[model samples]
Target: MDLLDDESSAGASNAPEFSVSELSGAIKRTLEGAFGRVRVRGEVGRVMKAKSGHMYYDIKDDRNVIACTTWKGQVSGLGVLPEEGLEVIVTGKLSSFSAQSRYNINVDTIEVAGAGALMAMLEKRKAQLAADGLFAPERKQALPFLPEVIGVVTSPSGAVIRDILHRLRDRFPRKVLIWPVAVQGANCAPEVTAAIAGFNQFTPGGALPRPDLLIVARGGGSIEDLWGFNEESVVRAAAASDIPLISAVGHETDTTLIDFASDKRAPTPTAAAEMAVPVRLDLMAWVDGQEARLSRALAQGIGQRQQHLRDLSRALPRPETLLNTAAQRLDLWADRLPNALRAGIQSRQVRLAQAGLRANMLRNLLTTGQERLTTLDRRRPAALTRQVNTARRHLTATTGRLRLSLLQQDVARKSEAYGQLSRRFTDLARAQLQGRRNRLDTLDRLRETLGYQATLARGYAVVRAGDQVITTKAAAAKAGSLEIEFQDGRLTPQMEAKAAKSRKKPDTPPPDQGTLF
Candidate 1:
């Protein structure tokens, strides 16, 4: 037994050991061989997307979690990205990442678990977006009656595009810009978003004419196939687009989020094309009808105006009759002019005869007045000489009295003015001296009130450290010594160690405050 055990121990000691990487690779090959392809049903969780166009996420059940990865090439075919909390069935081969030393699913196909779950998700997203006013009627734009250029977003090879072009051509031929894109897959949302944004980014009248209207169209399909149009990315892109958009994503019964966001919703791509342009024949007929109505209205208006002008012309008097009346009045005035001149001359003659009679009466009155003047002239010389001597003596006495009164009044007025001036000067000098005395007294009182000695006398002391006044306890604690000034004198206070520590509480009242006086 000892010999057998020794041989087994020697063999165990000689066995080879594998490194971490070698063991991981071996496990990877074993898992790949055992479960080459698998189908897992679980709720999605913790989805992470790499910038390299690769997605990494986990699918979890009540008890277990499995990591999943989808490469870029396969991602475009994924109708919808696996969102967190979404229940889906993943179909792919089980593979191990040797670098991470972990096993995961390399997913190639993902689908919602059931119709019920998909409907529930759709309803939830619809309610969430509807609450955000994405479907507001006020936000919908009016489609252009006739667009110069119509941009279509659909698969280039699909019959949907052909249907739209045919309908547009039949109604009214227009410039059609085709932006080929995936209509119902993982790439659909992003492609649609980019196309809508590209149309908006165009500068009008540039190398590429900016579209006046846009049509987002696709053929009818199952809910799963049409889900890309319902994606938040595509819906938001449509809502944010500047150009008027028409959504013809599926059959009339198929509703999507893009339908709510689009400016107009058409039952089919052909219907969308019809909405984008008006019928050329119908428009021409409408224009013709308007032209006929305008012509009739203009002719009727001109006839009415002509009839009114004729009525006004009949109401006015004839120009010849008016001139005949004027001529008759002129002839009558001409005949009366000579008779008026004769009457004027006769009145002047009567006025001249009255003037001659008045002159004769004046001559008789003048003769009477001259006879009376000769009687008074003989007695005038003797009376005038006697009156002149008496008048001269009275004038001399009146002149002497007037001179005496004038002299007395001048003397009295001068004496009174001199006395008043002397009194005013004395009063002014007294008032000026009083004002100066009062101002000097007020200045002296103000000086005494503002003086520091006055504040000290009021039970306040100025504490100084060197030349600076110490207003706070912190300054006193920092100083080696302090000089306290009172109204009577100054004293030097020595700071104790306890006082320095007590100064920490600056808000506390000083212990020697009561004894400061």
Candidate 2:
């Protein structure tokens, strides 16, 4: 046996030998060459994230276990972070760490292995959050119609933030405060939660403007990438936010726990901006339409009033026409009275002459009468003249008095009628004027209530791109620039380049554009 060993050693003296590092390196190369990039399915175990931003974990099946490491750069993009006991599929390259002298996988990506396990976990979390009353509809707050300051929790460098800002600029330009945070990974949840709480801490009207609304946004990705939003801390923070919060974590189909906790859930980041403000041109056009309607109503009312006045005038008798009949009657009475007196005097004279011619005995009477007549003849002329003059004077005096009395009575009657008619006309005019005034006032109030300016006065704002109003996120994105109109003034905010890039991944197609005016 000794002679055989000596012969073998002599024969193998020229053979190459390897050091520990060399052997390890050779083994690593061989493993990489054989497997290259591999997909390993297993249940996660003993996961630990290091302070150096690297992740260390174990993946094991019932019979075998393998160690895995994900560097910080790859961790951000990993759709899901590994948790103990979670079933997952890890894709990575097999390599050896010479210092540790052990083989491990350098993970490139990780994802939930099957839909069933993911759903179970999601259901469990959802049930827990529901039991906590975080998903109750009554717990939600109302979003502002227009926010003066918008707070955003997202990765400042990611496309999600850019998309949100761009959408806001297009919908309504507002002051935006950014709280940079990790969108995904172990650190993502706490940072997001802290950001939400920090925004609430800002004092309103202070040097640092407080947010009226908060937007927790992220771009569309796989379930793992969006898992941070489903974390209990993030969900709780969203539910507890004093400022109204909007969750725009992913595409419409991707829903997270935060969606239920938020006041509103936007299918996409851009959609959140649309929910914030109204189109400026559309509002102005609506105001103009209301004004025109009010004017038409008032004009029609005035025309109706004028027609009523004309009808009233036609129904009333004319003053001059009524007085004419009274004047005619007075003239007829004046003409007949003097004639009647003259006829009575002539008849008496005729009777006296007939008696004188009757008899001789009457002749003595006649002779005496003649003597009387002769004696009276001297004074008769004077007496007759005096009696005629006295009768004429009395008749003249009576006629004058009768005419004067009739004139006064007729004048009084006509005057009283005129006064009554005047009073009635005045009352009618006043009533009509009052009714018109009331109607006009009512119309004015209606106009004010329906006007867009009134809405603006109630803390709303309008958004415009150039002369056009941006009614949708797509339209705003296409516009590239925008103007926000408030009750007091207009603002145009500068958009970042990141926002432009985010427009490329819109979940919905752009809507048709139309003129507001």
Candidate 3:
């Protein structure tokens, strides 16, 4: 038994050798080869979309769970995005990532598993959007009465576009901008969303005119075919559009999320066009009716005014009848005019005589005025003298009432004030004089301390050659005569030498100036 065990161990060791990477690669190839493509039906588990645009999720049944991955490029093509607790069918190939050493399905397309699942998702999404107020009635816009340019969002090759164009032509024709887009399938939502946003981006009066109105139309279809319009992106784009939009995505019985979010909803594509504009024929007929009514009203008004004018003419008097009374009065005045002139001449003569008498009265008044002026001149000097005498008497009376004691007291107070002021002035003068003396003494001391004499007394000296003081040896050498000064006296170089000879030692004090003299 021991010999067999050793042989079996040697056989097992020689069987094969593989690194971890090689082993994982082999398993990956086997998985992809065995199940090249598959359709998986299960309820989606946790769904996570990375910032890198890759989607990672799980599909699970009663006990088994399968990992799934959808690349960024493939994500947009998905018919129904996987959600937690939603049953879906995913189509892709089975593959294994060597780095993770785990097997997963590389999902290419995903869709709701059944009608029940689709309806459940739609209801869930509808509730969420309603909660966000995207479906609020207040958000709806009023469509233009007549749009100058209409932008249509629909499949270019579909009957829906043809129907809309035909209906618009039959109604009030307008400039139409057709934005071709896929109406159904995985590309539907993104294309429709882009179309809506693109239409709104146009600048008004630009090279391409911006649409006053937008129509998103599609022929009648089942819920599955119309599912793209129910996408959150499509619904939000419709809701947020600045241009007034009319959604005609399905038949009258078919409803979509866009219908709720759009500015208006039409039962069919053709119906949306009709709502966009009024009937041209009807508009012209109404205008003609209004013009006719205006003309008839204008003519009736003119006729009524003419009849009223005739009635007013009957009440007015004739021109000749009005002038007759004035003419008769003029003739009567003409007959009396000469007599009135004669009386006026007599009256004027009487007035001239009265004026002559007034001239004499004025001459008498001038004489009286001259006499009065002379009298006033004579009285002026006497009145001025009397006023002056009266003022003198009043002053004498005022002086009589004065008290001698009060006057004496006033004089005493004045003298006391003057004496006090003089004392203060004398004290101030003495202080000022003392301050000046003190300052002068300080200045004198400062001067003495700074003087050369004071420096010489402190064992220093100033050498002099005549008026110039010799400070350096070079200056002394250049001088005609050199003099050296000690603290006690000034000496010529010859005298210094003689004094050194006479001195007992070099350290001896110099002779005094008085001694030198």
Give the candidate number with the greatest lDDT.
Answer: 3
On the 0 to 100 scale, the lDDT of residue 61 in model 2 is 96
Clashes of each: 0, 4, 0
Q: What is the C-alpha lDDT of each candidate?
A: 0.85, 0.82, 0.87
**Model 1, C-alpha of 29: deviation from truth (Å):** 3.2
| Of 1 and 2, the candidate ranking higher by lDDT | 1
Q: What is the TM-score of each candidate against the true structure?
A: 0.57, 0.42, 0.59
Q: Which ten residues in a row have the lowest lDDT in candidate 2?
A: 354-363
Q: Sort by TM-score, best first: what order?
A: 3, 1, 2
- Model 1 residue 429 lDDT? 47
Q: Stretches of candidate 3 above 4 Å error?
A: 1-30, 33-36, 61-65, 96-103, 146-149, 169-176, 201-212, 307-517
Q: What is the C-alpha lDDT profile of model 1 across 1-517, one tens digit per residue? A: 9999999999999999899988888898999999999999999999998999999999999999999999988887777678888899999999999887789999999899998878878888889888988888888899888899999999999999999988888889999999999987678889999999999999999999999999999999999889888898888889888999999988999998899999999998889988899999999999999999999999999999999999999999999998998899999999999999999998876765554554455445444544544444444445444544454554556657676566445545644554465456446644654554455455445545656788988999999999999999998899888989989998775655557787876577667645555
Q: How far is 484's C-alpha from truth in model 1 (Å)?
A: 99
| Model 1 residue pairs with clashes | none
Mark the 10 consecutive residues where model 1 has the least summed lDDT.
Answer: 372-381
Ranking by lDDT: 3, 1, 2
Reference-based lDDT, residue 339, model 2: 90
